[model samples]
Target: MNNNNNSICNKSVHKKNVQHPLLINFGENQDGDGFDEFILDTFRFVGGRRYHNVSSSKYFLPNDLPEMDRLEKQHYLFLHIWRNNFSAPVREKIITKRKSSLHMAFEYPSAIFIGVDISPIFPSEQKKPDNATFLQNMLDGLPFEDDTFDFVYQRSLASAISEDQWKNDVIYELHRVTKPDGWIELMEPEFLFSKETDAPNCHKFSRALLGFLATLGINGFISSQLENILTSTKLFKNIHCEERSTPIGQWGGRLGEMMCNDYIESAEACKPALSQFIGISHEKFDSMLENIRMEINQNRLYYKTRRFYAQKA
Candidate 1:
């Protein structure tokens, strides 16, 4: 969520003559612990209304998954999980830190977290001692030495790296820094989500999402197949994976209700930005979202989510 670093990074990479004020303001507002506090407060206010007794999800990093040959990427999973499990603030913190700590009660308190989309400006202040770090330097790649971390984690950087070599290099860097016997974890979701009883073409929003990502040469549609990527690396063992389907609009329960409501609100809030960047009309967007709500209300709209976990050899 730290925009300063990313803006600089983006500007440096693009080397363009333009400076975007919205992007600049977004960066400034997204810095430090205060931004996280805002996001957490928002989540508590809205998310509390949806589900009360849900336990924190288990933490997973990008390097963990089964089926090393599957063609799934990490960032898509991170965003889907964030949208499903987190509010804007909580997700901002999670992405900016590139890691998450859900089990402080576990033995290695400092070593446990989910690292994805971590920005250089925001250190891992969500946890005590702050043991993890992610470098955003496109030129420098990752900043860690070989075997520097017990786990390597990331997701949702598809737009940031357009070339296969850059992606491969980043993965190679991650593998080089990961300690032996450590673990790699990844979660990915297909750009589209659908309910079982949805009407024809109701998943248009998801489809458009896929189209946008495809334009960037990003496989935005990766979901439930992360294990293939892990297996291809041949650096991990003891792979474990699971998949869950959540209803989109129906009153499946508190979580569903919260997710639906948030999705609506966030979609509306981002309408202008979406239009500016993606050229989609609000009317069309709302119609699609409304369709999803109807499907959910009828208890037929559902979306698939996948998880992957693996340990190093």
Candidate 2:
């Protein structure tokens, strides 16, 4: 509350995240090009992380994702575990610090403001996600050297590939590229009834559909077994699994109803895939689905969704 305190900010929060408008907007000379790329190349790298060589060495902080995550975690780690953001000398000053978070507000405004960061941000006609370089290859052959990314995330490929492919190819590729002290996460669904209830049509239909998945060489039970599968590799440490009991009917409320509808829609796509395994006509399968829908509601079913995350040693 001092009279000498800053009043007019530069239409921004932190001085680090904000820049003169000329850098962030177009010059009006012609189509905006080269400026962004040129500015980005100036974000000098100290070791492997990013730093602003444009600034004097007084503010020595790397504005990389790990650093950003740490700053956010530092706030919570102090607040919840240690019980504050540690500006305890004057809590009012701490409040001021919070009110001035350029990154927490603007830095995360869109993943566009992010990079693998844009230096002083940028002026561009197109925004790229994480400045991500999109490349594609078979999961068996991820295009990277050993110990690459700081983190890896994979989801919902349970029905596309065989169990062997999952165990040998996909998981291995992820592990092989992740750095030590890094982390990887896997999310999948077991598609099992949470409890064995008297939903005959629901039970029958699930089995029939799983039989369909079998023909495609998918491990339909992948979600339930993900934790075990990850542990079997023994390549990671501090493995953790979180399970979600997603309700399957209106009785479970809004989220449950949506989950139920999603399952129905997913199942409906099975006819083309399922036709080879099950000899039922399209009309017959359609009728079966109607019964399954009614039975799930009557029986109060729940679906299993599981996520497993672990750190590398």
Query: What is the C-alpha lDDT profile of model 1 across 205-258, one tens digit per residue?
Result: 555555655555556544444566667777677777666677655465655665
- What C-alpha lDDT, on a 0 to 100 scale, does residue 232 get in candidate 2? 94
Expressed as tens digits, the lDDT of each residue in 119-223 for candidate 2 is: 333223353323222221222254345665555555445765567766766676667656676666665677668654487777777787677667656678888
List of clashing residue pairs for candidate 2: 78-84
Please list the C-alpha lDDT of all candidates, in the order they appear. 0.40, 0.50
TM-scores for the candidates: 0.56, 0.59
Best by TM-score: 2
Q: What count of clashes does model 2 give?
A: 1
